[model samples]
Target: MSALPRLSTIFLAAITTLVAVLLYSPLFVPIVSSFFTISHGNVDWSSPTLSTYVTLAENHDILAALRTTLIVGVCTVILSVVSGTLLALYYHGRRSGRSILQFIIFLPFLMPPIISGLALLIFFREIGLERSLLTVVIGHTVFVLAIVYRTVLMRLQSMSRTLVEASYDLGATGWQTFWRIILPNLSSAMVGGAILAFALSFDETMITILVTGTQSTLPVRLWAMMRLGFSPDINALVALILMFTVLLCVLAARFLIPRQVATERT
Candidate 1:
């Protein structure tokens, strides 16, 4: 009986290992290609070089697109964080037509990206708004607003009502309470949400492609280039972006996890 149980446990462990390998193999293919040469379904075992990195530096068009992407990402992060936080505060406990409005706020994120992209494209045309980086920023803010709002609201709800009540009980004015207590407590969540929003904006391509005018973001540019096959430098850029995204995720987790654990303990 003991031998049978051990054999079954070993079989389950082997199956789990096989599943993990299957899931990560697709990711491994790209990371491997970024550094080493692959030909005819085989990696060259000779050596690796930084030639791709050098080539990426000279690719001014792609570099320009990357700059544009960064600008849009920053703008999206700022707008979404500010607006989402304000909206969350405004609607936290109030129920006056807010449920429907909140639903509208979340609709863009809940809908498919293609649908949201098309809707925004049409809306911009109706409003005579030129399809530019500004339009892209608007699209990204709308798409990511839900994430920021949800993050901030979760933090706000987790906060002790006693903290705010104590502020008032201690003779602090409304602005004083907000500035000293509420804002400070919510700051970490806002920062984490901003990072998440920026990361999403950096990689956003579907809505951006529809709403973009002359300037395209990095993901859009990559999509265009991918149709004609990727160059070596593009691989280098992908490697860098993957690393940056991982860093952002780490930073976001660092901020979000502690707040969540504290909330749970409280």
Candidate 2:
């Protein structure tokens, strides 16, 4: 029995390590290549330099796409957070058609990105809305809305009802209780949801490709560039984006985990 357990542990550890390497190796390559020069399909490891990053700064096309991506991401985050919070608040503890409304809100997110993008594209065309950054923003917001709504709704569900009752008992008005007792409790979840929405918007490619007119976001631009072979600056850009994504993930985890733990305890 002891030998069997030891063998299973070793097998699981090996499988975990293999999976980790497979998942991260592609990301690691760009980060490593960002600091070194690749010569005729070989990396020159002798001299590392920051020239690629400098070149990335000077790449106007890439920078423009990056700017568009940021704009879209910010818009998506703002729209999704506000709309999602409102929807969550409206549907919370409501039994009338709540399940159907929740399903509708989540439909886009649950669909494959390509399918969702295609559906949005068709809808826009039917409505005579031209492809543009606004369309991209709208698509991203629809896709990420469920995430924000679910986050806020979970937080609300976890929150103790006594907080609101106590506020009312203390002679606080409805608006006052919401502003003080509710909003304060929900702030962390909202922040975390915003971070997640931004991250998803930043990385979104298929929908952006379908919805964008003259301007493309970073992921779409990178996809176009891949056919021509990647410039060193592209590698640098990927590395920077990976770092930014990691930071956002860390921030989201920080904001969300403590509240969840506290909720579980209470």
Best by TM-score: 2
What is the alpha-carbon lDDT for the whole of candidate 1?
0.89
Number of clashes in model 1? Answer: 0
**44 Cα displacement, candidate 1 (Å):** 2.6
Q: Rate the local accuracy (lDDT) of all candidates.
A: 0.89, 0.92
Candidate 1 residue 261 C-alpha distance from true site, Å: 5.8
TM-scores of the models, in the order given: 0.91, 0.94
Error of 2 at 228 (Å): 2.3
Off by over 4 Å in 2: 1-4, 259-266
lDDT per residue, candidate 2, 1-266, as tens digits? 56678879899889999999999998999999999988888999999999999998888998999999999999999999999999999988687998899899999999999999999999999999999999999999999999999999999998888989999999999999999999988999999999999999999998889888999999998898887886888899889989999999999988877756677697
lDDT of 1 by residue, 1-266 (tens): 56678879899889999999998777666666777766776767587877777887888888999999999999999999999999889878687998887898899999999999999999999999999999999999999999999899999998899999999999999999999999999999999999999999998999999999999889888888888886767777888888899899999988887756667797
